[model samples]
Target: MSATRLTVGWVPLTDVAVLIAAAERGFAAREGLDLVPVREASWANTRDKLVFGHFDAAHMLAPLAVATTLGLGHVALPLVAPFMFNLGGNAVTVSRPLAAALAAHGGLTGDLADAGAALGAVARERLAAGQGPLTFAAVFPFSTHAYQLRLLFLAAGLDPERDVRLVVVPPPFMVDALRRGLVDGFCVGSPWNSVAVDQGVGTILLLGNAIVPRAPEKVLAVPAERAQAPEIAALIRALAAAAAWCATPENRADLAALLAEPRHLDAPAEVVRRTLDGALVIDGAGTVRSDPDFLLLGANRPEPRQADWLADAMVAAGHLPQDAGNAARAVFRADLYDAALAARTRG
Candidate 1:
């Protein structure tokens, strides 16, 4: 019999490794699933397409699921994330010009406090000079990337709304935007940050973990109505297998190769390696870090807290109401996760 084909949407980030791993490692095949990984433009597009039924499920931003569940984005079709794909693959990178200004003020290597203070000084100088407000980019308005960026600015006593301009730029064009001076800085996921540093168009300001430790990244999100399907269960199980394999240090190189597929990132294997290995790259400085910090699609990876935290982020960002906790939990689908973990443990 032919395998059941399922379409899974994903943005072009290194953290979406579970979807790629399941496809490349034959785990999906073993589960009798033909997973067609659809590449999306932006988080908003991914969420909209998934809600409209253009996608069966997606590698979604955690906040988008909570927002959709609360009808914040219009049409509250509940969605659930049974597994987290990965974590801590994001960074805040400033354009070369902005980096130069910050460097001139002090340097990029300063701790988070100093970095924010330097940027604030720059923002003030620009304001006094009667120049336009400095603009920054984030992947989505409701994403952790955005909120984290805002929090970082706030921690430095810079008002995100008044001192700097925050806009949504597609991840693929972040480097180009920096090169063209369209934006001063961006908070985006890996490969893009590595790509920017490699191209010499941008400099890394801080890692996502530096801003917020143990941050939730991507998740295997599905519409709540579709969670009843046996195929969805199988996909979650296959994701578990792929996550188990990916969590092994021996599989790191192989996982990097899969991410380097021409149709996917097509970035250098070394860049992908650093991303998977959680090494910090500052102006192309490759320093090995012990954290790796990636939350693969696994039972141990704080999947429930991922939901709670994401929902809280959505509420914080004004995408969802704070009282929608019950509704948010309904969409996180811990039962599906429990089932997937049981199967993984049994076999």
Candidate 2:
């Protein structure tokens, strides 16, 4: 019998590692799936393509998946996440000048609360001095990166809407945007933050886990109607196998090399490896910070609480109304994930 051919969309980021591994390392093939991993430049393009049927599934932001189902920012199309791609793979980075300003307020203490306090002081001082609000960029309006920024602002006691400027920039362009002074800081996933730090254009101020420990980041989103189809189940099992492979410490070097290919992240293998191992270089001065939970790929099961967290974040970010009850919970098909894995075991 011929394998089922499925087209999946993804942006070039470290978190998309599971999808890439499923395709490149024969996990999908083992499940009788011919996975076609299509690389996209931005999340909006990926979401649009998935919604328009250009993709069977996609590596999607957790919040974007909920927002799409709730029709918060776009046309109402129910999408469901049967498997989570990753958690806690994001970091906040600021330009060198901004870093210096923050240092002057109180050195970058590597603590999220301390950093927020220092940033709050600087933002207020800049406003009093007749300087415009410090600009920051996020990959998308409906992303953990955006929410992390809001959490930072709240910790600093600054209004995200009025005290600081938040804009959308593709992850790949974040470093350049900071370099050109288009934005003073950004919250993005690896290895872009590493790239910025390596180039001396930015400094890593805080990791995403600091704001929301082990926060759900990306998911494998598919049309809600097809959530239980056999092919989708097979895809989920394959991704689970692939994610397990990716989580093995011995396989990280090979995985990093595969992700460094020109068609994928197109970054240095060492940089990618460091990110996978959670030994990140935070600044140009060769400062290394390690955290095992920096990016958790092994535990890929979809959880309802993850959905609840995302919905709460959306509401807090003002992207969704407080009254938007439990609608987002339905978007994460944990039952489907469990069913797929159970079938795999039974078979």
Q: Which candidate number would show the highest lDDT if scored against the true structure?
A: 2
Clashing pairs in 1: none
Q: Write the per-residue lDDT of candidate 1 for residues 1-347, one digit (tens) a residue.
A: 79999998998888878888898799999989999999987888888889899999999877777777767747877888777777667888888778888888674763677788788888889999999788989998768889888877886677877888999998888989998999989999888988888888888888787777778777778988877788988898888788888778789899888888878887887888777787756674543333456333344333566667777766766666678666556666768878866776787
The weakest ten consecutive residues by lDDT in model 1 span 294-303
Measured over all alpha carbons after superposition, the RMSD of each candidate to the real structure, in angstroms, is 2.2, 0.9
Q: Using Cα atoms with residue i matched to residue i, what is each candidate's TM-score against the true structure?
A: 0.92, 0.98
Candidate 1 stretches with Cα past 4 Å from truth are 105-107, 284-291, 294-302, 344-347
Tell me the whole-model lDDT of each prediction, alpha carbons only.
0.79, 0.92
What number of clashing residue pairs does each candidate have, in the order they appear?
0, 0
